[model samples]
Target: MRGIADIFGKEWATPSAVETLMRQNKPKGFMCVSCSWAKPADYHTFEFCENGAKATLWELTSKRCTPEFFAAHSVTELRGWSDYDLEQQGRLTDPMRYDPATDHYVPCSWEEAFQGIGAQLRALDPKSVIFYASGRASLETSYLYALFARLYGNNNIPDSSNMCHETTGVALNKVIGVGVGTVVFDDLAKCDAFFFFGQNTGSNSPRFLHPLQEAAKRGVPIITFNPVREKGLESFINPQNVTEMLTGKATPISTQYHQVKVGGDIAVLIGLCKHVFACDDAAKRDGRRVLDVDFIEAHTKGLDEFEAKVRATSWNEIEAASGLTRAAIEGAGQVYVEADRVIGIYGMGLTQHVHGFENVATFVNLLLLKGNIGRDGTGISPVRGHSNVQGQRTVGIADKPKLVPLDRLAEQFGFEPPREKGMNTVEACHGMIDGKVKAFIGLGGNFVRAIPERAAMEQAWTRMELTVQIATKLNRSHLVNGKAAYLLPCLGRTEQDIQATGPQAVTMEDTFSCIQGSVGLRTPASDNLKSELAIVAGIAKATLPPNPKVIWDDWVGDYGLVRDAIEHTYPDMFHDFNARMFTPGGFYKGNAARERIWNTESGKAEFTTPTMLSSIGFDDAPGRYRLLTMRSNDQFNTTIYGMSDRLRGIEGRRDVLLINPDDIARAGLVDGQMVWLVGDADDGVHREVGPLKVTPFRLPDGCVGSYYPEMNPLIALDHHDIESKTPANKSVPVKIRA
Candidate 1:
């Protein structure tokens, strides 16, 4: 085992360092709560996670955003500021609409901001508006966002989910009845074996690594397959845990780690399922007790298609396709077949590739092959990244299937919702390019940096009739102004939530799909800090008037009524949500959590077999390398907390790209060598869509990885996961040049 110094590349760790890793959930979000939609009764044991804590701190804390701060700096001045510098300026002091005459954001009254927002909405054909939801929205606020959008007669519910997990819903609806994950946190307790694929638990979902660690401690085998080697998969000393922190003790994590090539998850997943099926078939042929034939026959269909693909797949193809030896894959399969209570979990590493959705389906098939569903310690867990991202999608946030959302809107408030489909986040940006979408309203999020195609995304926002952001702090998106742009500040996760009704809490979902409650503990950083719900209400009031609209006031003030509205919209799962969520762990909304009842067409778990892309050609063409934009220890998504990457040997900088020794030698470059990453495709894109300046380090040969968002400019926006429209963050074809 490496020393603690080796693990952290520094002294044991620091409190601030630990803090960046711990913040995730807090109830004092800029939105109000509604118990029926699963708002927490209050903070429970483990009420907030580390990442949640950081998010809360970033939201609340002692930071202040006052007019004095803005007066000291202009938009052009803020343009040269670093990400951390921008965030450190603190919470917004007041509602400020951008004034072109002064080229600075002057403080404006809430009344004028609302009046401007309402007039713009009133002028637009309601169908032209797009309401974007960040996962950070509370359940109450999420429901309100959906309701207001639909009431305005537009089904353009493009949300963060479309950018991330829409494929899970799209693929699972055909295979699993419902479009959600199939595991709960408790499910990990009974799991005899765990399979983690294409996930880096260290950065994306650090809290989840605990379960894998516990499974390892219990002597349960954990097979982790990913394209890149992640440090979090190793032993992690939970610095926040008193005993672990004081004792300086750590627990071992992954039992075995396998590095699969980019886009290799599909083959590896299918290979596991095929081996399990083969083991069962061999047992049956030999009159031996091996296969879960009874379960397979009783609960699954399309076995014929599955086995056919498995049987037809050549061993050579399997080995070549997955970048794994036949023995290695079979070993993973052996563990799956041997363990009675097996669980499979994956992340964006699986879903960001070309065949990402298919990869997810195959994992479900592996679970079904062993009849793992609905059983303790057995199911599939997709570790989501953002806190409230899943919640944003759960409440009618989608581009298609307008009827159900529209009908529910009409049923709830007697308004005829728009039946036409809407634009997704990506589509919204693209729509802006084509003059299809006019106004862009961000409920809460940094859209310009969060979305791909930096130039086009910014341009899209610039072209809008009005671009508004309900943000706690200034971000790159806040500057992406339209003709009539405004920056309406909102409360953060760490601030005191207040509405016309009372104090409120925004809700978010965890990696395990369990709904929990969060409330901020810190005092409001600024009096001007407004709740996201209040901002939306103010906007809605301004946009639509006594224009014969649904009484938005009915749902305003007390968020409890928002829960009632959500329950009315989606009754099956949210029934008694207010009461149950108030009881403690809030509420769990996935089928895998609710007694393994998969909401599928056959009402049974389904298996999928994927074709392999074996034998990747590592053609030595000068500086060619597989590049993956990455996150660091001090970064959450695009929010860089600091300039340190403790895991990758990076220090005080994110301007370098990691390259293996052999790759450097082959490319005729040295460590710390300055180089330009020349993109390979000739798509005739913008000037910033190609190569980028980067420093060098030792990484895997033929593999290169760099920090995201900043490095994101290097990746062409057109190069995306075709299925999900997720930026090609994990996989990028590039060349390292002088």
Candidate 2:
């Protein structure tokens, strides 16, 4: 309740917002602005989580950052403010542009802002502009952003997925027919065993605790593979559970939690698959069948080669690389061997590494070893973080736009979309660094703060000729200006988006590919603010030439027209899109993997074997710790609710480094000691971030953890997964010094 009150102030709170909360809070109501965890079709009295409520309150807060407020604070002054301070100044009430002479943001008319931006955009080469979109925006906004980019003859539409789950999609596409998870939310309740590899659901996706608790109550095994024993995974007391909350008792979450060292997930996964093969050999000797030979032969390819590779991998190498005992790895295999159905869930801990793409494929390989893809209560579930991230990618926002989607766009909209692939997050940063990209526009996100190599990104950003941000509040990105910077304030998800048609509702896709509706019920915080759809349409209308093929005004006014366009673009998937949007719990875009139909080049699920975890020259060093970045429970992405991380047992600070006690003693460091962190990257790029206070934590030996964005500077922009091009944020070789 304090968390809720802190985000949504007390004095100016409205009863109408409460009514809307009671009416449409997701799974039963509309949708939420939190994580993209999938919701069941069944309805509940209250379907929201604590973090979801905090997100809602943060958006609908009564405070306002009016024009007068900006007049009092200059851009230089605001830069000194922390991330919390900048956003907490209040909601931006009007569109503002940075004035160079005064070092301040001043209000400008919407038309003037759009015209100036459009003229500047038209003056530059198409390849020189970069359009970045975040998951927070709706599908309509992302679609328009992509369309506008392609219409302008450029494909440089890099999005938040580039930093989060691009590896998941890329890996899944190669292994399976589709690049999405196979199971829906209901599968969580039906699975006999749940295997979590490098995922801390407690802090990332709290709502998952509901299904986990229920599964645990039914005596199902919940096995976890993480370096640190997170509190959310150990035990959880659901705030919505009256009995548990009143009694102060918590339900168990992880029945068997194994601490795998950072960057060791692929090795661990290989060990598990190898164990299953050994079990199959023993069953054959006993004249019994343990392996799904029928499924393997009929539904998959490359089993012979995959099995040979698994057999060639020695147990000694597996144990050493995985930082696990042979018995523990085999024990996990035994659990999987006994269970008829299993669900494999993984988070960034599995995806944010140099071998992130291979790490994801390893999970798929483990599942396919048991034929778990197309069965009840079983499949691969890659839990995405931001809400609607899946949806944005589903509609159009791909850097490498596939031929099918591009063809669909041309057939539906009567224009030839750009065929060339564009820059991803890493490439965009490099483009800026090289002065190839001149303009940068964000749909909704703090791009500079979210990306890696912050120092370099900041320098690259300043080199740009134009930078525009479409946001709800001030962030570090707005302050880090280019030659010309503009901030276009837009309505939040909790505020009413009254368009020319009427009150508007946007649709979002969850982690499981479930599409749902979201309708804000509160009055607009500022009449000067516009909806994301309107903002996109305004820019497109100003920038693009008049054409009968596309109608920007009609599409923005009535989102129904946008839905119709989407339906026409993806007929097989989004047919009757408008009708499905009104369904009680939204419709599911079924994955072909769930039907045992492979869509790969061979028309069968392929088993991919990855050779390396890190690059070839990754030499191991003693007294060096592998540093990974994570968010505290009090924060969501770049937004700060408070500084305290209650679950992690920290308070009033974000600069604490979590180090293993043994490693601390070995490094000759004491608890609460201040130390500087220097990068040990093999690329010869020097980077440092510190004077961070070191705190002894219960993590694996030679492994450490710190909050992200603060540690972003340590990650070199060029260091990423070679296949997916995602920045390796979870594993950075660093040395600490007093």
Q: What lDDT is reached at residue 475 by model 1?
A: 84
What is the clash tally of candidate 2?
0
lDDT of every predicted structure (CA atoms):
0.67, 0.84
The superposed Cα distance between candidate 1 and the true structure at residue 275, in angstroms, equals 2.5
Question: In model 1, where do residues sit more than 4 Å from their true spots?
Answer: 1-50, 240-247, 402-405, 545-549, 590-598, 601-604, 612-623, 686-701
Best by lDDT: 2
Stretches > 4 Å off in candidate 2: 9-15, 613-617
Superposition-based RMSD of candidate 1 using all C-alpha atoms, in angstroms: 4.7
Q: TM-scores for all candidates?
A: 0.89, 0.98
lDDT by residue for model 1 (450-496), tens:
77667666766677798888887778888778888888887666555
> How many Å off is the CA of 680 in candidate 2?
0.9
Over 1-738, each residue of candidate 2 has an lDDT whose tens digit, in order, gives 566666566325565667766655464355778898765566556676667777776777778888888799898888888998888877889999888899998989999899988998999999999999998889878777788889888889888989988988888888897888898887888899999987778778887888899999999998999888899899989887799889989998888889988888888888898889988989999987668888989999987887788889888888878788989988998899889899999988877888888899888989998899999899999889889888888888888877238877887778898888899999999999889999999998999999988887888888888999999988999999988888999988877778788888888898988888888877888889998889888988888898787999999889999988888888888999988885655688778999999989899999987786332124569756788888888888888778878888989999888998898898999999999888888778889988899998988787899998789989888778778888888888888978
Error of 2 at 195 (Å): 0.5
